[model samples]
Target: MTDEDRYELLGEIGRGAGGVIYRARDRDLGRDVAFKLLRREGSTLDARVRFVAEAQIPAQLEHPNIIPIHDVGRTRDGSLFYVMKLVQGQTLKEHLNGRTSRSELLFAMLQVARGIAFAHHRGVIHRDLKPSNVMIGLFGEVLILDWGLARPTRGLSTARDEHGGTMTLDGDVLGSLGYMAPEQARGEVHRQGPPTDVHAFGGVLYELLTGRPPRHSRTLGELIPRLNELPEPAPGPLGALASRCLAPEPGARPQSGEELLALLERVT
Candidate 1:
């Protein structure tokens, strides 16, 4: 068989800002896999750096809730790509196409928190955690999918973080604007830490409860002001939890993913 024939691309299953995913079969392994490739050929330095960086993060992480990457390499045509398990269900965004009850929302957020906790313990931070980055299995498994925006938190960021994960050097930002933490939005990359992810996690929880991002704002200019004085969320304890997570100051927020998850349990 030809080198290009190793994987039989079935069809395009999903597409996003990062890349396009295809449902394919590993002919030699006799199994199905989700193969992802950048939408462009990654010819530029930024694209090439991201192509390798994204694959390395997931490959290094080992968690039940994190998607496992099987292989990463260049295609016969020299385009970069990676292979991962094909989750049967849809993203948290798609799963929430209809209204969700408080209990169900809390349950999913708990799983998301737990996954982030696992990553945090390992010194990795998911700089971009959102509903679209989460995958729910047919049997109710929650898997954190993309690690493209993840990075080590022990030191000041370097060129890669600035270009790939952090706000761009020129003031452009990263991640979903509606879910971005204030520090991320302000381009204060040095201030990001575990709480940064916690802030995004809170934003996710807010969306889970209210069906929109915190304050329903979709742009950085709109989100930053509201971050300092977020409108009160739903009528009870979960509302309090959301507020704590979205605290404008990183230090004021829940210190870790585990701390946030614990608070969620106590409140709910």
Candidate 2:
């Protein structure tokens, strides 16, 4: 069957700054799948490279909690496209809209921690861990979405744009503002190691527990200092652990994602 005959293009599922995701079905496979079509219409060389990087990353990583790559292909006009198992669930952000029991939320985040820890062990830093990137399915399965920003840190320098912020060189910010670490926002290449993911994870947990990030600064300058000075609102040992993870100094944060996962499991 042809493109039109093989898959019916259902409406978009989510729109990110980098790509537009659609809910489509595979006629051959007889199942629903999500297609992330790269927006390369007016992209520069660097942007195209990053888009290809995103496609390769997910294809490489195979984990139960991570969305499974079904297929990677291109359109007749040359747009980059890839398919993944269409997750049936709401984003963690959506799940937090109403009141829910604390036990239920902790259980949900625990799965996220496990997934991140697993990915970190494989030398993949999510770089973009936020509520919207987490999908909670009906059977309590958590799927980490969009490995688009994941970078292999073997020797390649942290990518950046002209403005000195973390970017793909084509000048698009890879992650969302509210969830990005201070160093990531400054375009400081040296400071964007795995610990940056730890900091973002802390922000996600903070938002889950308290309904807001620990630091609410509207700008990068405003956010960095507040990370050190202000105390997190999360109660008990979890609050202390989160504070350590969100420390302004990257070295002061957890040494690895596994360490942070251990702390979270110990607390809840």
Candidate 3:
């Protein structure tokens, strides 16, 4: 049986620029899973490589806060697909819709920091970090999702495909606008590192404390100049930390997710 035959697609969960994710059932195991299939049409070669790396990278990480990949294969139609645990919960963005408990929000953000710390320990960096990418399960479990932009931090600064071609070219900006670190917004791919995610962690925390993101700019150009102009967060330690994370210089922020986790632990 082929990869597609082994799983039954129940319905589509969502769609993104790279591909669509479906709710599927594993025929052999009789278990429900999330099947992400790459877009066959209009997908560039770089996107394809990143899609495959997304699956491969997370599979190597066995952290409780990170989504786990169950299987990966190509469909009979030649489309790349991967199966992962089907988490039942709303994203942190959605979860914060009607919630206002500071402690609860801090707990969720702490879990996200733990996950990112583990990935950094494994020599990988999550270039994209935002509340939307964080899922809070029905049982209060926090899991980080969508690692399609992750890259190794060992020897190279920028990610490269098997053929050694740069996957994220210089000046090829990626990541969400408000959550992006200043270096990321400028498309300084080489400057991206653990500090990059720390900046985003601050943005997430700022949004949790305030109703909006740290930066209110609607476009990259608008955001660049106003990167340092952050709205005041909740009046406390958490708020203070958020401001530190949003510092324009990467050195001014926590050096890594590990450092961020440590700092967050001090917040009561």
TM-score of each: 0.88, 0.86, 0.94
**Ranked by lDDT, top first:** 3, 1, 2
Query: Which residues of candidate 1, in runs, are more than 4 Å off?
Result: 1-4, 39-42, 99-101, 154-172
Model 3, residue 81: distance off in Å is 0.9
lDDT tens digits by residue: candidate 3, 1-268: 8778999999999999868999999999999999999956777778877887888788888999999999988887678898999999899998678664767788899899999998888888888889889998989999999988888777433324474754646224778887888888888878889999999899898888887887767788788887666566567898899988888889999998898899999985
Better of 2 and 3 by lDDT: 3
Candidate 1 worst ten-residue window by lDDT: 164-173
Please identify model 2 stretches exceeding 4 Å from their true place: 1-5, 155-174, 219-228
Q: What are the per-residue Cα lDDT tens digits for candidate 1 across 50-141?
A: 65667777667778888988877667777778889899987888766755566665677778888889888878888888888898888888
Error of 2 at 109 (Å): 1.2
User: Whole-model lDDT for model 1 versus the true structure?
Assistant: 0.78
Candidate 2 lands at a TM-score of: 0.86
Candidates arranged by TM-score, highest first = 3, 1, 2
Evaluated with lDDT, which candidate comes out highest? 3
RMSD of each: 3.3, 3.9, 2.2
